[model samples]
Target: MWHSPSRRRREAGAANMTRAGRTQDQRWVATAEGEHLRGRRKRDTKPEVTLRKAVHRLGLRFRLQRKVAPRCTADFVLPRHRVAVFVDGCFWHGCPDHSPEEFRGPNAALWEEKIETNRERDRRNTTQAAEAGWIVVRIWECEIRRNVEEAAQRVAETTGSNEAPRRRRPAMPK
Candidate 1:
C-alpha cells in the first residue's frame, strides 16, 4: 500500500527521535533543574575520586566500574578481596540523615518516587552483589566529604587488609 507524504515524513521524524531527544523532552519543574540533571555525573565524581585516592594511599588496588552481578556495577572493586564499593550521593541515594522526608514544588511526587526507586535499586544491587560472593561497601557522599580517611579506613577494614604492603624500589643503574 502507498503511504501519504505527510505520514511518511512524520514516521521518518519519529524514527529520528533518539534517546537524546527523549531526554530533551523530559519535563522539569525549572530550566535550572534540567541543567543540573544534565550536569550530574554517572562516574568519576569528586567523592568517588577522593575515596579512590584515599583507598589507594592505603595501598589497596581496585577495578573501576566493574560489574559484580547483572545490572550491578560497583564504583570500584577489590578483586583480590572480593569487595565492591559504591560511593552514593546522599540526595540521589536518599540518605536517612541528609535527604528530606518530603519534597515540594510541581515535581515533588516525582522526586520522591525517583528517590524511592533509587533506594530500591540500591538494595537490589547490594543483594545481587552479595549473592555473587562480593562484599558490598556503600559510602555516602557526606560521609566521604566529612572524613574521607574514615571512609577509606572502613573500606580497608572491610577487606581485612588495613596494612599497606611494602614495595621494593628499583636500584640505580650503573
Candidate 2:
C-alpha cells in the first residue's frame, strides 16, 4: 500500500491533531462556537461600514486599515488629523456590556484567556499609536450598533473635524 506524498504528509500531520480534531497549533473551540467565530469578519464589519458612512457624511475622509505605528493597524485613519480609529467587536474585545464574564465549555479557560489577550493587545496598540503622535479612538461594537452617528461623531470630534452634519433637503412637489 503506497501513499502519495501529499497523503503521507497529511498522515504525518494527523499525529499532531488533538482529540477535538484541531491541530496542535490551533486553539480548541466548541463546534458551534468555532463556526460562529470563523464566520466573524476581521474587517469591514457592518458596524465599521455604518460608522464609515456616518463619518463620511460628516465631511471627514479616512483611509481604511492603515498602520500608523509599529504593530498597530487602525480600522480607519484620519491622516490629516493624525487620528487612528478602532472598531472593536464586543465579544472579541471583552466588552463590559456584551462579553460574558465567565466562558463555559471544554475550552472555557482558553476562551477567557483569548478575550483578555485581545483586550490587552487593543490597549497596547492604542498606546503605541498614541505614543507615535496619533490620536486613538476605540469604539465598541454595541456603541456603534446603538447609535452609529454618535460613534462617528466621536471620531470626528477626536479629529477636530466636528463640523455640522450634512442635512438632507426636503423634496419639492412638482
lDDT per residue, candidate 2, 1-174, as tens digits? 998655665777786665556676576565776867867889999889999999998888889999988888999998989999999999889999999989886788888888889989998998899999999999999999999999988998897755665566988989
TM-score of 2: 0.80
Q: Tell me each candidate's TM-score.
A: 0.83, 0.80
Q: Which ten residues in a row have the lowest lDDT in candidate 2?
A: 16-25
Q: Which segments of model 2 are wrong by more than 4 Å?
A: 1-26, 162-174
C-alpha local distance difference test of each model: 0.88, 0.86
> RMSD, model 2, all Cα superposed?
5.4
Question: Which candidate number has the best TM-score?
Answer: 1
Tens-digit lDDT track for model 1 on 82-111? 999999999989999999999986668778
RMSD of each: 4.0, 5.4
**Model 1, stretches more than 4 Å misplaced?**
1-30, 166-168
Pairs of colliding residues, candidate 2: none
lDDT of 1: 0.88
Best by lDDT: 1
